[model samples]
Target: MAFDVDHVLAEATTEELAALVCGSGSWHTTGIPRLGVPPLRLADGPHGLRVTEQLLTQAVPATCFPTAAGLGSSWNPALLKRVGEALAHEAIALGVDVVLGPGLNIKRSPLCGRNFEYFSEDPLLSGTLSAALVYGLQSNGVGGCLKHFAVNNQETDRMRVDAVVAERTLREIYLAGFQRAVTAAAPWMVMCSYNRVNGTLASQNSWLLTDVLRGDWDYSGVVVSDWGAVYDRIAALIAGLDLEMPQAQGRAEAVAAAVEAGELSREVLEVAAERLLALTDKAASAVRPAGKIGHHDLARQAALESMVLLRNDGVLPLAPQAKVALIGAFAATPRYQGSGSSKVNPRELDRLLDTLSARCDVTYAPGFRLSGELDDDLIDEALLAAEDAEVIVACLGLPDAEEAEGFDRTHMRIPENQRALVASLSEAGKPVVVVLSNGAAVEVADWVEETSALLEAWLGGEAGALALAQVLTGEAEPSGRLTETLGLRLEDYPSALMFPGESGQVMYGEGVLVGYRGFDALEREVAFPFGFGLGYTTFRYDSLTLTDTGSVVTRDLRVAVSVTLTNTGERAGAEVVQVYVRNAPASVSRPVRELRGYTKVWLEPGETRTVIVGLGIDAFAFWSTPHERFVVESGVYAIEAGPHSRDLPLSGGLRLDVPRLPSALHDESTIAEWFADTEAMEALQARAVARTGERFALSEQMYTVVAGQPLRRFAMFPGGVLTAEDVDAVLAEYGRSV
Candidate 1:
């Protein structure tokens, strides 16, 4: 039978819930079994799925993917999609229901260590890629959940610090990605973050959970709390966050008790129950109809696709059967993921040396440290191991403390011991492949300059080890791209000062300028710019077209873009063609260019094809003020489309031949976007969006009625989109003289 949440909840009682809550009958239910499902489920997530009884570690070994920051850097959506599919297959084999992943939090600051788990510094890429992952996972009939919903960008003080972004910026940058994922993928479940968004905690944000997720996006799935994230179950239920995970605290009967005390409404209770039952309904459905999947090979393939090659000299593809020196304790003891709520006790963990040894004569040296550096003795031993080896592969990077969630990292340097080991090994004049297993961006200048190759095997889970093995053995081509910039130094960013000095408040004086915006604003160069990553194969670019000029500045401007790509290698691979827009001249300082559109393509050896993407006119405009609105300023815009930001292959310019938006439209969006377009509401919004940041927020009235619709044509659709004739009809209805 199809699971009916409403019906299931109607049959549920406080007694039944209590019996299950205190560990009675496993909360088991009898329903028609789905086709593809296992008899019982063991789940994985926040990172990936899990199986067996042990909470952190389990029976089925899951190949862990790289952290969000590392995957984000790859900027390869196609690879992410493949990774998602592979995860789904693994989950099914493990009898897992959902793979809780593709963490979609914003990168509020660079101090965040888990940026590797997310994608893009911008919302568009993050949301777009997340949706792709969710879609691919569900393709296997195993649901994947989009996670850490709302402002959970930072890790240090993450559990307590409130992300107080302005309403407009919040909507455009932070929440936009989550909203997109919800609308596009409709993941089986959404896991709320542990932090507060706007003043109320995410677990209890009514507008966020109800008005936005369920109301706007109409998300029909269940909402799970980040482990230990639930504070008040009744309030969280009233606010519409359902299903506290790792099991609920003392509040399993809180809803019934609230109904008895008249503190919570029966309506709210039913709504929560329905949502919970709805989750079971979908899982039940997946059990009915199944899909075909190849779990083992998919795991290895995903890891291969997700691995990013930061730098490589002529020494890659280590001669198929080369005897290799795999140094570093990390080779044996891998840190697949950071510790905290998202951490899982995997059923199986694959170590790099273990996986690599199967393919060739791979010897190891215990050379990793509490830091990602080396000691003289360990280095000498590693160097000695490489004595007769054809290539030297050293696995070095951060440990749990360096990338943990409790505190911000004081420095972004490799540990002294690991540094000594790597630098010393580099002196041997042998091909040294340095594999970095970290989550955030690190200063690898020294290592890059000295090493023969660099591979970022970010906490690639169960499959991470074999993925690295394939890249070494030439079985698969490296296709991962970079998501964030790897600055030569941390201070290169404008948010540097505001970063380290966090005492209950951090000012976003940089405003809309973040990631590439900061780099473009000061004309400062980055070691690697945003939207950057190198592929083993090569591609070409040509053909740019800009179509449709708009009369109103804020109105849509359509521009078509095209590029020619050839498989400049013996092997076939994929590439992400990025389109960035440079504002010719603006009222205010703008970033060099913002990412507008991107497409991924695959090519066989010597094959060629052209790709064209459309650019919206609004992509050229930025917010000047709530009252002044967004003025195109009637200028030129430079369109650069290619593999990466700094690596633009084609460039062209187009004049804005448009008129400024009528003051009403700009003001309407500004006021509607932020509660502070006028000077009158500025102070109120500052306190709400900044002071208490997440706690205090703009009143709904301020978000809406401040400025009426531009011309009320919003209600119009198809032929009804108010032509002058429609306006005349409206005037007739009002009986007013026009």
Candidate 2:
């Protein structure tokens, strides 16, 4: 397979362009022939594969992959990579060039109705997993599309609401996931989100499209607008949005009109067309081979892997013969995945009732209680089921309707019926296991005390029932880590104080303090901490080594992590090693410790292997404003590595030298650090002052004065609002000030 010669086609494509665009046809329908190859099509992403009777039958058969929340629950990059490969196989088979997937939007709010389709609240977890998935797809002949490009944090007013995040926070948390995906996977396409960032719609924001995507990341892939996401086609093209999806016929003509009208440039159009051609070349020359995958089996495996056992008391891994009285309507009709685009038609689905029925005397009972409201009759039914059962399995959580793709939930409590049902079951003294299916974290404080065990099964797609069976039967040990913290309530969040601001331009008061940072900073203990998950067998960590010097670099210090397993519970299992780094003492307020690295290992009973995790400077570094670079501030770092964030094996005092000189700061550092020697700060402060002329800095947001002179008010009336006179006065003032 020869790679597309982009440089050649970029200029003329004379023979190539003649075939592609020429075949696509000209203004006069009679002038040119129609395109031989049908145009590429895209389906809904994020939740499930949204396809219909028309698109699926004709095009290449693409495999619909798991949603973001389910994938996040797994926390296994290797698994994500495999999912990408599998989806690619489906896409190639379906003749689908680009599988619209790997949505990397940050889970900004728990109330966000569409969270089931998204991954973690943390950017790194979502970014890392998404990147792996992308790599797997592109490695084959398919192009993986990383979607909802910028600050598409919510679903309500998603197409109209503006995400007014600061430049720093935008770079660090909100856009980090997309950035990581681009940097790691280099996908053929990046799908633009239908939302506004700052004041400009993402579709028309040059800062997001041109400055961030092309300039900063050097992302050479084509960027397509979400279907009907385009408003100003010319502005979108000028800002680096290459293709309008679904091939809106009038869009390109409008673009051409704009170019001829001097509103845009032929050069910009050429760049977009070149990028589009690059995608065509890549997709056309793929190594597609016929392969059959038992999607149900794979989905079941993924579901089992993704399920997190939040709480347990030696009552889990139920005996196959146990009279498990299953309660709740979700048992029969599972909310396998979220609604809206990205919905895929699974070959088959497994319900919890069917799974339990296959192995045990399952007394199926739908305790007819709405989630928040407990009907007396439903409570009686649930209690009756519990009366006879040795153990009870309560399939509980927000119904699909409770959390949809629009509007935030007013609160996070489980409905009254589910709560009442659980209370009745608890009183019966039956060992109970509560299964939760939700997109984001919910307040589980009330249910925590009574429930014997709790499992968070985020909307698993396809083999959801089978996956639930495996976890219950102990086929695959639960090892998924939590991607977000389960807070007491919405008010517990620091951002909850200021987010969803009045009017427009919501200020990012917390700056980069997101996810666990909010919980850690406030010293509030959440119901469940990030990375909290359980495995069937217990593992141990020892032989901790940290070398400042010698054969190993500081980053690769042979950090021996060993866990001797006796299969304490008569079952084969796997465990996820979560490594977090804390700057015990730092220049700024950092998350108690950020997730630095992690690993998932499978070990048999009585088996032991020493796992050595390599740490790097990048792990210690944060976005340093003063240094204009990723800097690892000097401090006594604590490297705690274990299963889950709270259950980490403590290792204290891994020290590193801090920056002491100005030369250490990169060329881009525009600010001064407090710890920096006075000489460095002095030089940087002087340079900063000179750069802004001590008057019109980047902070002022507009040109106010030149050099050291301050400009007079720009035609200000009683109120300082902009007017035609104000605009002229500003121009005049700047002219005189300069």
- Counting clashing residue pairs in each candidate, in order, gives 51, 25
The per-model lDDT (C-alpha) reads 0.67, 0.68
lDDT tens digits, residues 627-715, model 2?
45555666677877776767766564676665442343322222232113455434434543454445212334342232222212332
Q: What RMSD does each model have against the real structure?
A: 10.4, 8.0
The best candidate by lDDT is 2
Q: Where does candidate 2 stray beyond 4 Å?
A: 1-38, 46-48, 53-66, 291-294, 369-374, 547-570, 658-677, 680-738
- TM-score of every candidate relative to the true structure: 0.78, 0.83
